[model samples]
Target: MIKLTEINKIYRTNEIETVALENVNLEVEKGEFLSIMGPSGCGKSTLLNIIGLLDAPTSGIIEIGGTRTDGMKDKQLAAFRNKKLGFVFQSFHLINSLNVLDNVELPLLYRKVSAKERRHLAEEVLAKVGLSHRMRHMPTQLSGGQCQRVAIARAIIGNPEIILADEPTGNLDSKMGAEVMELLHQLNKEDGRTIVMVTHNEEQAKQTSRTVRFFDGRQVE
Candidate 1:
């Protein structure tokens, strides 16, 4: 479902150059839940970003669901990403000013979806994530786990084919983290959504369909 060939990401300045990923080639099958495990400074998040079309590699080819993305223009990329990808960050990127339901409805605003349809879809995903009761709550009013659940609802509200989650449970306690992991597994198993998650938790990585480890910007396992 996703493929990266000899991907290389580098940050260049007039005096210095840093490599975030080097000659990394990886693939994830459709409906597979893959975990990326690595130490800090490794290229896990960088790889996830490239796969999600949020960032471009300095060199390499990326293909998602059989479409090559190497030469897509900015407009084309935006359209494609909006339709095919969903993202959940370590820090829930909710709009603080918007209530839970409104935050979950943000992604649909990019498409031509009507307000009525958007609200309905948002409500459905929130129910799926067990956040239906928190729809009217503010981010400040919810626990860390609730915030992340809302983020997941927001990510899936559009029904994207792939979900890119970066340290999804990093900020929560064990119980809450477990709850979130169970929800992610349900999404993958029941909904058949392909998930690629970056995580430092070994136990969490163990539960995924496959785990790939990275070190010093390269795939080590």
Candidate 2:
């Protein structure tokens, strides 16, 4: 459902130029679960950001669900991203002041969904993540695993077609990391959501349907 052709990303400073991605071409089919694994400075996160439309590529094209995103305006890209993508990060990225339910409902709020509908959707996702009872808890009140579960719920609350996770288990213990990975697998296998996860763990990458290795901004076989 996602296609990248000759994707190139460059970072320029007054004295230096850094190439984050070099003519990267890849395709992820609908309902596929793909893991990107690499060492530090491999551009995995940069590629993920490009796929999520959080950053623009210096050249090449990206098509999401068949629409070309390369030439879209910022507002158009933002709207498209909101409607088509969900993100889960290692940091959880939850607002400290917001309760679990409110954090989960935040995406729907941007979509202008009605309050009743957003609450219902958010609550349903929270229940799926076994967080219904903790809906009113703040981020500080939850353990790392619980907080990650809340983040996962928030990511899926909008029913976005693709989930982009960057080092999702980086901050958790092995057990908690496994739990998070299991949840992501369940979403991919049962819910039929496409997932592109960037991680440094070999065992974690092995659990995914397919794994792509990267080195110094280039994909390795």
Candidate 3:
């Protein structure tokens, strides 16, 4: 579960101050698939980044699975994030040079896990995402949907409890997008992973367990 109270994210420069999130409060229950819907510049992705602890809120409290993150040091935050959260992005964030198996194993390199164990875990998750046959392929060799699947495999290989996805299907065709959504739904329903996704698709939002709408950095619904 995740909780955010009075969350505000502001970017300030010499003569300009922009509020990305304004006193936004949110709560995501365990095993819930939540969608955040909004137009561009409405802070949907900013909110997601804040919740994922990749960015800090200007003034607010963030609690994930009962642990308060506002006060955690950088090293502590990194360690906690590595263990408790997974991230998926529209851009796929895959290293072009690394093959599927190696990319999926990147997260484990930060931990004390051995190479053999990392490969085993990567293989298992790649299989879960139906990418077992493509493990040796490079990012340039895969389709958009396949790239996303590889990204998903990388995200889950650590078995993180929370998945934060931002515009996960933005770059794919409808068919590919649907396939990715099906995979996400399976992870949410069958694996019981908590997912908080930011999307612009109305139908996709409707499919989630709950949806929250935002406008001008404020949660409107």
TM-score of each: 0.96, 0.96, 0.97
Scored by CA lDDT, what does every candidate get? Answer: 0.90, 0.90, 0.92
Q: What TM-score would candidate 2 get against the native?
A: 0.96
- Please estimate how well model 3 matches the true structure, expressed as its whole-model Cα lDDT: 0.92
Q: Give the per-residue lDDT of model 2 (tens digit) for 201-221.
A: 988889765555654586534
Give the true-structure RMSD of model 3.
1.1
> Which digits, one per residue and each the tens of the lDDT, describe model 1 over residues 149-181?
999999998899899999999999999999899
User: What stretches of model 2 exceed 4 Å from their correct place?
Assistant: 212-215
Spell out the clash pairs found in candidate 1: none
Per-residue alpha-carbon lDDT of candidate 3 for residues 117-185, written as tens digits (9 for 90 to 100): 999999999999999999999999999999999999999999999999999999999999998999999
Off by over 4 Å in 3: 210-216
Residue 176 local lDDT, model 1: 94
Worst 10 residues of 2 by lDDT: 212-221
